[model samples]
Target: MNVLNTDVLVIGSGPSGLAAALEAHRNGANTVIVDSFARAGGQYWMQSKYGLERNDRQMQAGANFITNSENLGIKTITDAEVWGILPKYRVFIQQGSRDSIEITARALVICTGAHDFVMPFTGWTLPGVMTAGAGQRYVKMYGKPPGDKIVLAGSGVFLWAVAATIVKAGGKLEAMVESSSNQFRLFSLIGRHPSRWTETRRLLSPVLRSGVQRLNGYRIDYAQGEDRIEAVKLRQVSNSDRDASQELEMETDCLLVSHGFRPITEITALLRCEHQFDTKKGGWYCKTDPETGATSIDNVYAAGEVTGVTGAQSALIEGALAGLGVSEKLGFTRNGIERKRARLMKRQLRTARFADGLAELFELNTNSMPRIDDNTLVCRCEDVIWGDVLKSWDDGAQNLQAVKYWTRLGMGRCQGRICGVAVSRLLANQFDLDPRIFGFNHPRLPLRPVTVNVVHDALARKSL
Candidate 1:
């Protein structure tokens, strides 16, 4: 195997990754960035491959980061899907269309980021039902609207952004149903965290101007269609009387739903880093030193959404701190490094306060998900339903491991990334146990899907 060594290896190209790479390079370290996408920007600044029009202010911020990183002589390798990482900072990356090489770093910065948190609702497995994030990507990145008529439903401010993107793409939004009450608490937090004010303004502008029907305290009860989603059933969330919870049926070609985001902790978990279960942090996050972003393992630091679901501003600031911390740890430091770290921490804290408020306001109401009937599909990859999990539980499966063994719940192509949380939620609700106790499915080598031939070739090559 070809071994490429670097002083620092940053494993994402988003705002956080870009900042880390730039800062580390500035501190006199040989740094390289690897991302799964074709471009450097993460989800917040996802660029269109076909050169789509972007009016959102977030795009400019992302462009600035990209430009700064390029000017600092930072090297970025796009379309490199990192499947595995070993101890002593060895990274196994697969880029079949290009060169597949293994990377070894003196220090590692993990900014793997987060993915859409989708709680299973009735008919969620339907073809026309997608995540709000996916809808945004379709409109902004793919340069195509998801459908002619769209219904956006979920928590968080992200849905509004998705709505805006659709409107910008010249698609009609039938309605937007959010579970939150739009209370004053979230509004009050915006005042304290001025860093996010620009983004907040940009995301809300299109929605306010589009005049889309906004249902403040409503949640999707279910989606109904045979070939594709034609309509959705919505219920008023604030109503105390279940029967009086006004039910409305709205016709739509697509239904986009997302609760929030869940951090992609597979790599950190595989590294045996200690993690803490915090719903507000977007499920399990790698526990790190807030001052340095260092994990339990020496020379291994985590930044960005891998640590938590705090927004882009916090991610960028934390990345800078981690980059500086790595530089100092590697004996490459400049004057007043401590002062810089302190300033970054303060900024991170301010952004985090606003993020926390959003998380609280748009927290995934586990209660909002309609009760899963026996036939309701829970694990999409394995095609396992609620009945299958119940059967495993009945067969002396108490925790996730035993359940997985009996039902093959997490043994599918996704490697339990999607189904693990759903399984945990189901087990917790059924047994009245803490969801964290089940932990996550124990991670193994070859974290992502790889071709059989590629795996065989990798095994054939001797370790350096």
Candidate 2:
């Protein structure tokens, strides 16, 4: 095992991680970044492997930022997944087909980003059904459309961005179905942030020009397919009615869906940091100081979506603040650090307000839970259906762990990352209780699945 040391270790390479690394390096800390992807940029700024022309604003910005990091001599470990963290800020990583390496750092900055929040429906496990984030990555990073014909259905502005990307990739978009009926709320949000209008137009124009059907106040009732998705059934949704009888069936080879994003907080949770549940902030998120981005634990900080899903703009600012905080803690504060921190703090306030409105505008509709039948699979990894969970409840299972023990709901390769919240919502809607009462699935070591040899090698170095 190769052992390394750094003054600061940043886990993730997205906007927040890059910004944090840049700030820490400039402040005289030997900062290092590690990402699970093949390249440095994360989902928001995923780089194309085909050397595709850089036309989009995000791509160009990501390219420039990555270049700056390299020019500044910031060390980044690509294709490395941090599977475990030990006492004294010792991190263990597993790279592809290589022996695991351990890095001991003085301080740690966690910026692990978020993933799509998807609900289960009939035929959701079909071959052609996937989350919008997956579809975007397929098109943007791999330069391949998910399917020849795609129908995007979900709540939130992210669908529009995916639709634009599909259109750009020359994929035929059948329609875009949004669950939120309150377009006025979205317009009002954009109205306040005038700078967003340009981005709004940029994402929406291509989809509209292609004449894709845009349906608001609609939700996917279920998907229809054999082995793969060939069509989808969508029903009208409204606050007053909850479920309207009117339904629309669309033919498409692919169905991309996402209710919203859920923050990836396994690292923070594993470290025993304080967390608070807020749906608007993307479920359970790490609690951090607004001024410094410091978590409850000493020498550890969290930023970006791990703190909350506030988009890239806020992540960048929060990352900088966390970097500055770490530098100050390590007694390496540079001149004028306070002034820079003040400016970032003010900008974060504005972005946080916008994030609040965005969350409200695209809030998931709990009423739709009733439409999912008993046979629908809630935990895709474990193949646990809603009926199984209900049966567990009837058998005296009151909380998440009891249900898991009875039905094997959250014990899979994903380790409840995908199915924990979905099952919680199912039980809450059925029993009319708070979702938090079920609590969250406790995170265990080796956060992601790794080869047995990798774990053995890591353990051979030191007792974790």
Candidate 3:
């Protein structure tokens, strides 16, 4: 195993990670970035591999940022997955097929980002059903449409982004169903952040020109098909105590669904950093200082979605702040550092207001989860359905851990990343208690899946 050392180590290559590395390197800290993907850019800045000329503003900005990082001589370990972090910031990484490495850093910046949050419904696990993020990556990164006839049913502006990507890829967008009924809230965003008008217009232009049907206050009740998604049943999401609205069936080969995004907090959780649950900020996110992105632990900081899903703009600012925070902690402060921090802090406040508006615009109602069929699989990894969870509840399983022990609801390859949120909601609805009371799944060693050989080699190393 190769041993490496750096003054600052960043665990992601997205907007936050890249910004963090760049700032740290520029501030005279030996910086290194490690990412699980083969390339530096994370999902939001996913680069195209098809070698096709395109005019994507976000992609171009990401390319420029990555180029700047490379030009600054920052080391980035690609196609590497960090499996464990030991005391003193010793990170064990499995790089590629035949390489394993240990990196010890004086300061660590965690920007693992967030993943799609999808609630379970009937036929959700069937073929041609995926999250909106997956569909976007398929079109943006691989340059291939996920399906011919696509129906995006979820909440948030992310759905619109996916719809635009599909349209750009020349895929047929059947419709876009958003559960949020607050269309007026969207206009309020332009008032708060007038600069967003251009981006918002650009994002909505393609979908509007393509004449895709946009259904507000609608949700997917269930998906239907034989071997793949042939149709989806949509129901109007009512806020009042009125009679249920009629279900509408839409024929489509693909169904992309997302309730929202949840922060990837495994690393912070594993390190026992303080966390608080706020659905608007992406549930169970790491608690950090607003000014510096410092976590509860010393010499460790968190930024970007790991702190909360505040989008890319805020992530970039938070990342730079975290970098500066680390540099200051390491006694590597340069001239005008305090002034730069103040400016970033003020900008973060503005972006945070925008993020708050976004959260309100796409707020999810947990009460609706109880309406899902009992046969719907909540934990896709362990094949645990609502019925199974109810049975566990009947058997005296009151908490998430107890349910896991009784029905294996979260002991799967994803380690509860995919199923934890839904199961928590199910239990909260079943027991009529606050979802936070159940807490999240406890993180264990080997944060991500690792081969036995890699673990063996890591254990054999003296650094362990």
Poorest lDDT segment (10 consecutive residues) of candidate 2: 365-374
Better of 1 and 3 by lDDT: 3
For residues 18-111, write the lDDT of model 3, one tens digit per residue. 9988888878999999999988888788888864225777788898899999998999999999889987899999998657889999989999
The whole-model lDDT of each prediction reads 0.82, 0.87, 0.86
Q: Model 2, 259-352: lDDT tens per residue?
A: 8888898899999989899989888899999888799999998889999898888998999999888878898878999899989998998899
Which candidate tops lDDT? Answer: 2
Candidate order (lDDT): 2, 3, 1
Better of 1 and 3 by TM-score: 3
lDDT of 1 by residue, 305-349 (tens): 989898887888988988888877898888888888888888777
Model 1 bad stretches (over 4 Å): 96-99, 238-244
| lDDT (C-alpha) at residue 43 in model 2 | 76
Candidate 2 regions with alpha-carbon error over 4 angstroms: 240-244, 368-370
Residue 140 miss distance in model 1 (angstroms): 2.3
TM-scores of the candidates are 0.95, 0.97, 0.97
